[model samples]
Structures are given as C-alpha cells and as structure tokens.
Target: MSSAFSLSSGRGRGAARLAAAALVWGLATAGTIAAAGTATADEIPQNQGGATATIGDLKTYGSAVIHENGEDSWVSAGLFEMSVENGGMLQTYGVDLHSPTQRDARYQETSWNGTSLSGNAKAGRIRWILENSYPQVNDLAALAGKAGVTGLTEQDAAAGTQVAIWRYSDGADVDAAAPQAQKLADYLEKNARDLAEPEVSLTLAPAAVSGRPGERLGPVTVHTNAGSVTVTPPTDIAAGGVRVVDQDGRAVTSATNGSRLFFDVPAEGADGSTSLTVQASTTVPVGRAFTSETHSQTQILAGSSESTVSAAASANWAAKGAITALAAQKNCAKGGVDITAANKGDAAFTFELMGDEHTVAAGVSETLTIPLQEDQVYDFTIGGADGGGKRFKGVLDCKTQGGASGIAAQTLSEPSPASVGGSDGGTDLAETGGSGLTPVIAGAAIALVLVGGAVVVLVGRKQTPPQV
Candidate 1:
C-alpha cells in the first residue's frame, strides 16, 4: 500500500510532520493501545506485560433460587479487569451473580492484589457459604443474622437481591480464592454460546493469457462471484509486479498478506457479479503467474464446522514480440533522432540499441527518439528466430546527421553470413581445438579396449581347452 499521505514536494512536509507528532502524543496519553472500541470475544488483546486478560460476553447460564417464591440463576462472573502493574504486581477484579435475571440477581464484587494464590482455602469458604447459607436464608433479616452484616443486608433487601463485597489485604488470602475464581470462570466459558451471523463466500473467475516477454498483457477482466453478501473490491492486489485495475483502467489497491484476497462484505447480502482487471508486468517471462483466492464460510459460533473453497487465475506468457515506435522534438529545440526496430521474425527476439536491450516479437516494432548531438554514432544488435524456424543475427552502426532536421536511416543487416550449424547458426560444441573426428577416434579406442578385455577373459576361462 502506498503512504496514506504523500510529502513528495516541500509543500506538504510541515503538515505530515504535525500529523505524526499528534499520533505519538495520543498513544502516550491512552496508557494502552486498543482496537477502536470494546473488543468482542475473538478480538480481545492478550499478553500485556506478562499478564493476560480475556473478556467474555455476558450470557445467562444455570438456574438457582434466591427468594422463597422467586427462582434465581447462577452466573459465573469471571475477571473483568486484570493487569500487571509496574514492579511485577498483579491485580484482578471480578463480579459473580446469583439470580434468574439481572434485575433480581444477587452480585458480589471481589478484588485481589498479590503475587499468587495460596490454596483452595478462600475458594472453599466462598463455596461453602453460598451452598449452605444462601438457600436457607430466604429473607434479608435471616441473611444479616447469619453473616453478622447489618447495613449491607438491609440495603440488599430493599433492592430485592443480595450484594456482597470483599477485598483481600494479604497475598495468602488472595491465593486462597484463586482456585474458586478459576472454576467459576471456566464454568461461564463452557456455558456461553455464540450468536449466529451471516456467512459469505467469494469466487474469482479464471484468467488465461499468452504474450511475449516484456509485453504488458491486460487489462484482463476478472469477475467476482459473491455469495449472498455485498462484497467490496480488494484494497490492493499488486503482487510480484502483477497489478489489478478497475473497469476505468485505474489500479485497485490490494493487500499481499496471502494468496487469498479479502474484500469487505456489507451487512446486506451481495449476490451479483463484480468485475475488475488484472495486468501482467512487462518484465514477466514465458511462464504462468497465478493469483489465487481461498474463501471460507464465516462462523459466528464457536466450534462450528468450517468450509473453504479456493480459486486461481493465471497470466500466461509465450514466445512473442511487442514493439513500439515514435518520434518527437526534444526540449522543443533540438530535432530528435527517431530510430525504429521491427521484428519481422516468427518468434520473439532480443534487440539492443546502443546499450539498452529490449525483447521484440514478430510483426511488432519499437521506435525510440534520442536527443542527439550532430555526428554522434549509435550501434544496434538483434538476435533470435526470423522465419520458418531459422535463427538470425543483425547489427547496425549509424551516425546522426550533421544538421538539425536532417534524418539518417538504415535497415539492420547480418554483420556476418550464416554458417551451417544449429537453428541460430551457432554451434553448441565446446572449443576443444581438434576437429569433429576426436569423438570418433575416442569411440574406436574404447571399442578396442573392450574387445581386448573380452579376449583376455576368454583365454583365462579356456583352461587348456579343459577336456582335450
């Protein structure tokens, strides 16, 4: 992705610097960097400064009784706030509720600040009190008499549900409560189920292309088949010099995180076809460059079966030529020298003008206009198949005309006559000096050696003809 803001010229430099400074200042003030808002279960951040924090969405679970006539439910409330403070201190806070609904639920807020929990002592105390006292003490008067707490019990009675608060001063006291807290947290997590959300699937149409090296192929059309959802175009899709463009011939931004391209889907379902364009870079060679997308059904529920489908499109390059020619005035002053090179051959060939080299295909021509100094000399070289599978090489040397507006043109020709050899009129044999008879003599020598060895073997096995 390109920069969100460009400081290409000096005009925007000051504004860019100010924006960066403001961003840093905002982060420093926030104390913690979080995603935009309160994160969902899957989006919660974890492992902050050696302490882990997890937040689960509130959901109703198992039922219980608080009053004599009214039924109450137990909701395991896990840690809502947990942090590792400076100097290796750990702090945690949580709230548990027992009632059928939030309006009538009895809640207790508890906090602990310490190094570690001791054993199950505090957890046992809490569990025992809730199991033994809560069911029997149906009224506020009985609950206060049992716990020996007066004002808090009266307040809970007025509110119609009990409320308890606890804070541990010593590390050992906090340690005793850890096991029960963990148990409650686990229970809540196990009971909570995710709500279902709409699913979206994406499909990319197949693309095939054949072009010569150094030839730009596209804007090739790409169609997107979206499943029951409105899908947006990818933000960026340039990978390995391959570019994606829109219908207007403008490039579309795309991320390169993986072969799978992700596009935003609107809440309302997208069921129609969307089209884009893909272009292959000129430098791509004779082969296939493929871009793929794998789409999976989005699941809102935990432990749901996931299904994925993948599709790929390829840009194929072949042995062909693409060339161009143009002439223009340079600097609106000097008359430029326009040189054109056309590939009259059947296949792609490499053309070198001066020191620059380009690949040209059959029936294609390339023209270059060079700002010239009078009498300047330039050289050219062309090599590859010409026609009927015959390979050829051509070279040219020309000088610019001595005056402005003067044109000097010449057709390129083979600097040397073709000799009988390979298709390119060039032999693949290594320069070993001796004539082609070298391999023949070597083969004969090897044959004689083999025959002599065979004879020796026969004589050794004869044993004076054995039977005479």
Candidate 2:
C-alpha cells in the first residue's frame, strides 16, 4: 500500500515534521499505522513521505493563547505558536477552544529567545494598548487589567502558552522593547541605563511642630509624581541624609535612594511658630546598574522656626537629544534671519530658521532662512524670550523686488552683506565679523527677544539706531 506520508520542501517544510509527529501519536495511541481495519480520523493527513514523528515530539519551545466569547461563534483560538528553527522567523499558529464564552483570537509576539511565545486578545483592544505604549513592553497582565479583563486569572498562563517574542514589523524594530531589552543584556552591560539619584527642594509654611525627634513643623508640600505630597521633618534634621517625618514628626517613607535632609521656611510667620523652615534630602541605592547623582535646594524661613522637607532625584542627561532644537518660527517675505556659530551651543536655536539666537561656537557659519512681509521691519532680539540672561548679538539682512521712492521696488534684489543696522538715515551698514546690523525704512522692526518672556521693541526714526 502506498504511504500517506510524503516529504516536502520549501519554507514550510517544517509543517511536514509536525504532521508526521501527529500521525505517529495517533497510531501509537489507537491502532496500527499500516492496518486498514480502523478508519482515519476527521482531520486525516495525506502524507507523501514515510516520516515517523509523533505529536508529543512536535512540542513548541513556547506558545501563547487567546480567546473570547461574546458572539454566536464564540469559540476559536485568537493566537497560537509553533517551534521555529535556526534562531527565529514568523510562523502561523492554530488551536481549538472548548467554551462558548470565547469569541475571537490572534497572536502577538511579546518576548522571545529561542522559544517562540506569543499571546492573544480582542485584536482591536490589544492593538490600541500597544500603540499607546509604543516602544514600551507593557506587562501583559497590566494591559489586560487596563482593558477590563477582571476575571483573567493567572490560570490561563498554565495553558501551554508563554509570552511571545515580539519583533517590529517595520525597520524601527531596533529600539522596540523586546530587542532593546535583549541588547541591554547582551551588549550594553554596564554602559546602559541606571536608576535616578534622589535630590530635594523644599518650600515650607510655618505650622505647629511635634514628633519623636521632638516638636517640629507641620505638613509641607514635597514635589512628587503623585502630586505634591505633605511632609514634616524633625527639629534635629541635618543636611544630607535627614530622616523623613509626618506632620506630628513621625517617619514615613524609608530613607533610601540617596535621601537627604534639609528644610525651607516661608517668608510669612506661623502663629507662635518659628520662621517656616523646610528640610530636603534623598536616599541612595546601595547597588545599581548606573551611577546616580544627587542634588537639593532649600529656602530658610527668615523668622518662623517651622520647617518642611522635600526630595528629588537626578537621571542621565547624556542622551544626545536630551537637549535639542525645538520647532523654528516662520518669517515673512523679503527678509531673512541670520544665525552664526555663537548660536549653535543652545539647543533651542538649532531648529530656528530666523534670528541669531544661538551663539555661534567657532570656525562655523550658522545660516538661517527667514521669510518676511514686504516693507516690514522686525528687530530680532536674542537673549531669551522670557529674559533669562542668554543673549544673541547679530543683525539679519533682508531684501526683495518691491522698492519705492529712494529705494526702487523690484521683484528680486541681492542681499547687501551688512553686519549691523544703518546710521543717520544712511542705506549702508557695517559688518563686524558677520555679526553686524542693517537699517532700512518702510517696515516695522520686530525685535526677537530671547530672555525672560515677551519680545521688547526699541523703535527708532527710520534711521540706523545704536548697536545693541
């Protein structure tokens, strides 16, 4: 008799191995493989090879299961898994459900090594969560809880399933959680991310003081992600490593992660309380992956003796884009913005197309493209929009085709290379190493302030004004 099993080739040749294993299992568990006495099972295989593998041997290194039960056909596998060879590759999974509460299913790779593990859920819901936490490997249990899967007990995890090893379908898969975690363990080692160091900044208002360390100050705001929390410190609090206390001066949070001790006092007074004082500090992690740096700040109450405490921590800012250029402001026609090397260091000016906000470093000419409205003059100030002390010193040259009266209106005109604005109604300006100014009539000069907040304009009578 011709054998029902046959050898096949190509990408899915591995499927043949699975089939052979199932066949062997059936024959060994029930009847003879060559005997024609018993009939074939419902899902019979038409094998063209004489392979003798069994179902138990077809065990996958890992797998994931998904299920739902809301509709009529509320019974099917959402996502399943199969073993892959030579590292890894995508493969289809199948399964059968034994309940009516199950509706739909699909598979997703969450994590992996050699064994291919995956999971399944309502496609739409799971997809939404993944997109929101993009580039973050959200814990499966957490995601399920967020999706209202209240009864999703851990028992499901025992169903021959494992977390799937997710890989980005797109080229950006490099930083995707699974890949990144693997790289951290495989390559980065010590040169990777680390926990933050604790720091503190305290602002306190006077209140009655009392505690184990003795009567101190009442509760005060401590900056934290959970919103500002209330904190009280002991009167005996010292700088660098002070114990945390409650309003009655009781210790609360453990002294860890580089916690320090310090306090601040409010400018105003508290009833019978000494000048409002605040304490600050943080705890340091004993052993961590990366080194952490600590910092703190405090404002002492001039009169009140009460004190409050707060804490913070430092994280790595070594990442290149930790400080990067923000979006550039677009300019009007007939005018262009000039930026030099002096403006390069400040990340804020990197993406700005107009004005010389960046203080050009050296040996480089930073150029900018600013469009201006016809007959409009703008005085671009560069220090800081909010007036923070940072300053920019340079004038931009702008020209267009439209000229009138003393200056002819033309469609296009060459930019007169000038350093600063013109003087005494003169159309010419001087250049001081490309950091000069040019003055022209017929438009409003909008000064681009780089300091404090709003821009401050210095109006002049259509003539070159003093160099700023």
- Give candidate 1's whole-model lDDT: 0.21
Error of 1 at 194 (Å): 38
Worst 10 residues of 2 by lDDT: 291-300
Q: For each candidate, what is the lDDT?
A: 0.21, 0.20
TM-score of each: 0.15, 0.15
Model 1: weakest 10-residue lDDT segment is: 291-300
lDDT (10s digit) by residue, model 1, range 360-417: 5665656555443211222211222221111111111011011111111100011111
**For all candidates, what are the clash counts?**
19, 120
